[model samples]
Target: MKKVIIPLALCLITAACGGDENDGKTEPEMKISSCYVVSSSSGQSENFSSPVGMYITSEAGQPYEGSGVWSASYNSGAWAMDKPVYVTKAGKVYAYYPYSSNDSPPVLPLDMTRQTDVLYSRVASPIAPGSVSLSVKLYHALSKLVVSVKGEEVTGLSLSSPVKCRFNICTGEFTDLQSGQVTSTDGRLFVVPHVTVGKEMIITLKSGKQYTYSVDGTEFRAGESYTYEFQLNEDRDKLEILDISVEDWINDNNYNDYLRR
Candidate 1:
């Protein structure tokens, strides 16, 4: 029988040396202040950066489980969780509510899209110095809707209700934050939907004459987007659905709702 010999150092190399893939590499670190310590019900806070508590998970596309620190601050002798995390790759940082647990990511309620109740996420990479103040911007996680009309005789348009609060935002999951609204003579209305179902919306279109259209059921999905285009035929007797397309809420229009706070 022949005996085979293995090197002890080689057997332990993977465990000791390769365990830390980010070793020696300059990794990005989230600023402790970037995570809001407290938020007001009105979505505005004067001491939003108090650093009272925060739970964060930094992952490269996959979900992670992490615990946050309470009373997190730059003060000496604080919990390790209070410290910033170093990143090996560009990814998302899901920050939980103050003193919240990381058993799961935060959930947006069905009615959370209301301006009075807005939640946000933090996205950034290469977390270098000054990046904390300059590159970091909060974003709302909701969907939006826009409607427009085109016709030779069309003069004005109005809806019985504001187009902003039409859908149920609780059903589907959303990835990005949403805000802003605009209306024009052509019937331009921007809305945010918190649910995935459709609603019966009534609209009045006016040109040389006035016409009413029942947008009986228009569906708005979460994390997804939509735009409705109503075209008036030559007779203008009926409004036709010229197009319904998906839109990227980020690049489309106003997101200054944060400024109001």
Candidate 2:
């Protein structure tokens, strides 16, 4: 009786071990093969060299649990997610720069002092299942301001603009505006896209003297960049606009030229 029981136990263990190998395996993962930022001015696409956060949602506006960050691989130069993102059903995807962990419809608050570029992208159509590769195209979500000073012993600069704004990652729009000050030392600021009428640009000198100029009638649009070249008079109390140029952020080639003395 003991020998028969041992043989029966061994047979049951063998049968369990020989079951389907693929029974509990997860679905195939969807990988992002290529990601690029498109120039709004030139319609040119530049490959992403850094990591960005992404979110996936179903066609019915339900968020996918597998959403996570993606970055370019050092060896293959392809964008890969930190975790497996299964494309088991039809869904949409959204991506943003300066990755954050907030997975719910990814909204970013404008940090004018950081000078960080805000970018966003969304898939227009629902991606079908079994798609092994995806290509994402991102666009600039905020306007860039480049200020260059000439003939001035400047110490610092700041803009009296809307400092509080909620940037919608999906729609690439800015809302809930509030006015405040944003300071800078290098004369670069990433601001919410809006029209300026009564805002002020403050310039500080080595002597601690400050000058003000009205940023009137200037319109800052999404995906656009503006350069304001200023020349200080002999009195050093006034700033005159030397040049103003508007171009797409990614396609602007003359940005550095404005800083050259």
Looking at model 1, which ten-residue stretch has the lowest summed lDDT?
A: 163-172
> lDDT of each model, Cα atoms only?
0.41, 0.69
Give the alpha carbon lDDT tens digit for every residue of 71-95 in model 2.
3331365666766776678877777
Candidate 1 at residue 173, lDDT?
A: 43
lDDT (10s digit) by residue, model 1, range 146-191 = 5567744344444332333322112224445433222335443334
User: Which residue segments of model 2 deviate by more than 4 Å?
Assistant: 1-6, 23-26, 43-46, 66-76, 122-125, 152-155, 205-208, 251-261
Off by over 4 Å in 1: 1-119, 122-140, 151-199, 205-219, 234-237, 257-261
Residue pairs with backbone atoms closer than 3 Å in model 1 (clashes)? 140-177, 141-176, 141-177, 155-207, 168-194, 168-195, 169-194, 169-195
TM-score of 1: 0.37
**What value of lDDT does candidate 2 attain over all alpha carbons?**
0.69
Candidate 2 pairs with clashing backbones:
none
Model 2 misses residue 27 by how many Å? 3.1
